[model samples]
Target: MTLSSMSETGTCTDIINLRYQDGSVGSPSKPQKFNYQDFGQLKQTYLRKGRLFVDSTFPPDYKSLGNLSDLPRSVRSRVEWLRPSDILKAQNVKGEPSFFVESASRFDFAQGKVGNCWFLAAIASLTFQKDLMVQVVPTEQDFEDYAGIFHFRFWRFGKWVDVVIDDYLPTFQRELLSVSAKTRNEFWVPLLEKAYAKVCGSYSDMNAGLPSEAFKDFSGGVHMTYKLKEVHDRNHDEVLWGQLTRATKCKSMICSGTAQKGDTIVNTVADSGIVDAHAYSITAVAEVHDGSSNVRLVRVMNPWGEKEWNGKWSDESSWWNRVSSEDKAKCVKRDDGEFWMELEDFCQHFQILTICCENPNFIDGDVITQWKVMIYDGEWVAGRTAGGSLSNSTFSTNPQFRITVTEIDTEEKEDKNVLLSLMQIPSQRYRNDERLRPIGITVFETPAGRIENSFFRRNSPMKRIQLYGYERDLIEQHSLKPGEYVVVPSIMKAYAPGKFVLSVYTKTETSIEPHHEGEDDDDDEDHLILPTPPKPVVPAEKSSVYDIFKSYADQNGELSAWQLRKLLNETIAKGSSDLFDWSACRTMISVVDADRMGRMTFKEFSTLWSKFEDFKKIFNRSNVSKTGTLTYDELKSAVQAADIELDDNMVWLQYSLLQGDSSISLVDFLTLMLRMDNMAKKFKDKSSDGFITMDWNEFAADFMFI
Candidate 1:
């Protein structure tokens, strides 16, 4: 069946007349233009030569830096890589190089050694839907055409990217190590898995993930996660039944996960023959007519292809006898691990349901009436913009976008759905302890044309902020009226840098323009201007370091990293290298940071700074270079200048540990100097042998961790 016969997707309309009327959507970064060759051109190139497509974006020839041992000890794990020829036999049951013996099925994707059942379940669900598999794993590739090359496309960030891969796959003793199809000869399953693994950087990266993510990536669609309890609270069991049926009709992929007890993962089968903490694909949701009346039945397939719910409506259950033989045949697919269960039983068995809505405008032949999606790449620079939630502050300084929705989709019963997805850029691909920061987007229905600071005014109401309670690549869909809206994507922490892709999908004609903050040249200064007089400086008595910190930081509830440096510059010695040390201050902040939230509360800042204040003075007095930082030799000199002494080996070890330039900031200098002083002072006691117990507060105060 063709794509049009399978489902109806939205179309894109003409660009409306909406230009940047005011400030930027988020940060001040210039809008990035993606200029890769279109799929049409790439396809033509491949067909002309019968040569495989090799994605230039993420080249297949690239090799990964082995399981990153450099990652934080908390997250480190090993990964093994092998080739496909090392695993598969030369022929299958039919005695041919396994490309495909027959059409792919839900049974084709059985879970293997990898713990990516969520991903496998999504692939299985796609097999039942005609065009989804073709869209993801391009049919243009086959074993006969394979000159050791294959390519597949996936929806990533805000666009579909073609990922190329070789037939080589990880294996052990001629068995596929990761995902494998039931038939040893079938190459499409492993080829698809290999292509997907390349898109994620490594096979190891797909070890654990959500099926909703896989569905969204497989189809350039919007994903929504729903809790079973919330669905029940909203209405009756029939409500979810209608939803599942509609999803199946529209070819929207759906998957469910069973809840397990406690934090421990349980893989053993339950009494019902269903495995807890496992993902299962929703193959079909049908309202079959029984001899007495119509009954709602949902067919679910386990990726394991063995365990299944043996409750009512199961393969051998009495409920099948009540239904017509034709209906019974449709419900029971015994050995495939697919079984029918009543809609009510499904709700009881599954804890989470995730659905992916294919892009409404994603049609094959038509362009108009389809959903037009706009994707913007943005970064949250710590000192510049990456601020917390807008409810706590204004997102006027963050990246901002002006989206004008001209018309809503009139074809569907529901109003136009605006989907906004924020995805953080992937990082630390090889490292086990990859760091992640919470990120979210806030959309405000502003006056058609407004400036940046307008939203920051006192008590200005916000339309929608923090739509999803938590961050981590949030997706929020709203049925909104056709109009102009301003959106700002931000990291949840103040001054924490993060990169993200903001995807906007609307079932209408929408124009997304970056809001740039600039004064119109038309506003001329023809009138004579008067010279402004210099403001008089206020002279006041000096206060202690703690008192000075409270003065500058009281304006905002938290003290920023930059603010800390300014405080040190004013309260301590001026023109010292320590005063301008950004990296050192950041490092120092991490050390004193209690929650690792990056931003510091006033009390936390005061406690950390009070101990280093004396050392700042000592470092400042010895600042001959005045660069706001000192080299190892300069730091050593300053330490000796302060009459503190340490063994050469000890001094060298401390300096070597300093990151970046192997230099010391005011914070580091103060920390090192104080530690040496504490050691010397304690050594005066004959019984003291370099052992002293320091609380968290004392540790921050006494150490200059260069």
Candidate 2:
């Protein structure tokens, strides 16, 4: 499968084109289906059956309310589930209820009891851009053909998924409990909110989040965040202003949040009329001449549809007197929750500013500059591909994507040509239950070939973005010379299962593809060759080890592992420092136990004795330091010397599993070799067409023994 596709316009057109059957791209082996509930099919079926549709997937119940502990006692006690028709009718004296009163606007909705102003702020900002608005809330549906079902599309990871929800909404005292519309007959706000809540697993899961997080789910675009505290510097303020102005001109979605006061409760209203720890949308940004100088002003909207900023340049402020009639008229003041604030006060009050757009040219301050975007979906499967961080020996086993930068932007001195975004996909049915894994990305300048563990051992990463916390996404911008590079995404903890999407945005043309070991080369030539087994050590002519083995054997002439261990320590390992342990001796017996018995007969003992002698000589030779333990490389060489076949990845994995303190003892090495032999033999006997399928019991039995 292709790793990514490029687009010059920086739009989602390339992604749209890449989409296959259901607007999904990437590996077809396991494509993600959109809106598992088929709206059209369900609508027709329900209509034919003379019934209204009800979504069983996201039902109207306490489960949909999420964790009961998060709900207030008052809300939980009075909560009543109601459909839109019931909600509108209970309010009394309303015309036929409609999904939307008219064209949706920022004033259409007001935040309810949920502490999700961040989400409401993004929804308010979305209203300003109708094109983006329609992408999320399709304009095709209405009350005219109501089936009690509504679907909304959201950009999830790298694909758009349609989330369907029934019209049932939670209400308290006959009023919608979440987001409610200003017009009583309009039900779009609450319905849309329900759909989004379903995507988040439940309404409670939507509590307390960054606007940028919702903004990404809304547009799946390039998101840039600015820390307002950092903008206190004059130079940084100017840069931020330039970017915000350009972003506004480009019609990008923007939102900001107020910093929390010391131990202050969230949404606590201050005397200044601005809520503490609340989110707001930037509806507009302008610079007006106040007869003296240009005054930079920003229009901010509170999702509550009330409680607006009452400081200077506010709706009732006398600051409008200084500006000309034209500018004053353009900046109309009202009590609709939207008011103007001076740029200085805006920076002083807000802690974070976020902007998102399909095209990120606004970040460069040059809207004409277009970028090429590429996206890829990948997963980290435990044991096989979840190879943890760079410090891990199996890091190379993680998925790797190779990208070649063919050109660079020459307009700037040090252009950040590449932008990497790694987003982890949630694996739980409920967001509250999902524990996000700490994920990161590493980039390395390398030759145009598949990288292996050896390469990672010999080289260091050119760039690393380490997020040790449980962040859903990690993004970084890098400036590098034109060359081939490999990007590796991994979880901080080894062998943790998860999925992710990696998006690459470059200023110029680039090519990317997933790299697999030996995919581009001859497998036979790259395979490691095993050396000839060393000759067995001879016993003293008169003594003869066979005669000694009979003494340790029982009446049946069979030697158990305990007996074999005694024999070895007394003879072969008598003067040698290295000695066989009970576990190693047991594994050795298991390896050659053809009768499935725990003991070895004389014939079996003879065969194992010769191999054991050869292995001991090879191990001693490979352990040049005579440390009584072998490093990863030394152990690998010893295994090869004993004529055990294994590829580089397998050898690395085995060593990682068996090594302690970066090395393995002779006993551990012997056990490892024996287990590998048993596993290989089992696969050869059980596998069909190179794939083995075993039930849980069989798998558990084999795993325990192996």
Candidate 3:
């Protein structure tokens, strides 16, 4: 799909287009149903039944543990699944065993046996933003009314899905086995982890990941990551420090991870007391006045609840004596896994820094700039839209979006105005079942018209945004000129089907539309061209159509798409030497496949075949020049003659898609009509009150086969 945009003068507008291939724009709306499970009804049922809720969706069996062979024999044998109530009893709680000891904070939990420090680090950062934390871990949840069920919401793709799970957590030797709290009775840590694990497919699925992945899931916000080593090497410490200060002021979630030294294993403590390959949250950034000068300091917290940094500005270091009493009071020294380190030492030890926020105002420290965001939900169907990278001939088939940047940002010296983010949505329910494809986006400067295969073949891309690795998300900032540009996102290989969410954040007002084929450039009434009346089919031709249908009809007097294909190839299509393939036949059946049984009765087949004959007559009559193709205006007439009512935009979209050079071939025109009819019928059948709702799998099943 391709999108085209135009500039409009007004306050910043945020548009969210969801769940449709048509390039319609609108604001975001709530999904009528939640993914996986519904929380409210489930909880109420359990409460009314007077029984604890045991999630059959994610049971306490070994399946939920995911591959027990990866676990140590002793730990695997001793592992026991226990609910919060049972665990509290084992701990001998005096009073009520609360879900949380107090308001959730960074110090509330410690890392467990799972190698998900990346996730824990994001959680640790999440603790600082109360609003986001509440969104992820709803505060109303508690053990008092708990029905042995807990629910947490995480941003999945473009929506927030409530993930519900039983409170049953994996334990060993009567001790909490996952993310334990600092206080003995608090259970939020493990419960939250369990819910996330369920979302990832199983506990093992959450074993290792990037903090940015968890950060995006936690807040569904803009993510920005910096390589500390690169920043230090470029002598951009001040630039990075500025970003950190602004990020902290913006209340963005921040996290960093230490580099793994040569031949060193993860979590291994080095001489400086920093753990390798471990994630840590940046709690604070300060410029403390040390008697002689001001020292840039960063507060880092290890999720382990220990292993404090022993370098300069550490709790035990003599560097603290140089700071003023007021500064020292502000920066407390403790052995509780958190320590302040000099900015230089911090950069030297940490390899990556990630910050996430709902808005990206923190970048460039431009607090007043309100960016307009446009989000689109799209998919790459294997044979249809998944047209791989630039190297492939089918590259033009990839989804294309048009962005028209009407104005430039004068506030910034640089022309950088747009931020493009392409995130692939997982088709599977679990992490282990899905593989991240190497995806990238290509932006092309084109003429003010529909982009086609010829355009791509003739022109090189203006810019190619390549993600360094096969990552789930790719983000890039660009300084595009004020004009119409088409953005194409694709996997490195063709025919790899997947869904994706594309977000465009721009400083200036811009219109974004999916540059679908057959869409018309003009909708003006004066410029509209209606198709000529079709030449009447001879009585003999009409009689022969019925004769062919009767021959293909089975004992039940019904013909499947396959049978219809044979009938057409042997009859009307035989004269023109044009043969319909299985795909075209399937589409033809879907046009009248009311029962969706892939078969059509005589009545349905007669109606479809008559329309086909009428369309063929109109196709020939419209081709007055006898060029063996129909111009855009001629195609519109043929469509109308066949009683396919399409608005100017829809007509243009279809015309653009099938047109070669400046016109559509007879084969392409017929295929377009079949597709339009099939799509229209499917839409009417599936839509309810003008809306169609489907999960990823449902959408794939309904649309992919045809």
User: What is the per-residue lDDT of model 3 for residues 501-619, given as tens digits with 9 covering 90 to 100?
Assistant: 88777774666776644545453222111211111233664676556666666422457667788887887677664467787787777666543445676667767876677668889
TM-score of each: 0.63, 0.70, 0.70
For residue 29, model 3's alpha carbon misses the true position, in angstroms, by 8.7
Error of 2 at 151 (Å): 1.0
Residue ranges of candidate 2 with Cα displaced over 4 Å: 1-35, 68-71, 262-265, 464-469, 519-706
Residue pairs whose backbone atoms clash in candidate 2? none
lDDT tens per residue, model 2, 228-264: 8788555586787777777776658899999887884
Model 3 score (lDDT) = 0.74
> Lowest summed-lDDT stretch of 10 residues in model 1?
527-536
Which lDDT values do the candidates have, in the order given?
Answer: 0.60, 0.74, 0.74
Off by over 4 Å in 1: 1-94, 360-370, 391-394, 405-417, 430-436, 448-450, 457-472, 479-483, 520-706
lDDT of 1 by residue, 422-512 (tens): 8875433321234656777676666654445545554343443344334445876655567778777777665555567777776545676
Better of 1 and 2 by lDDT: 2
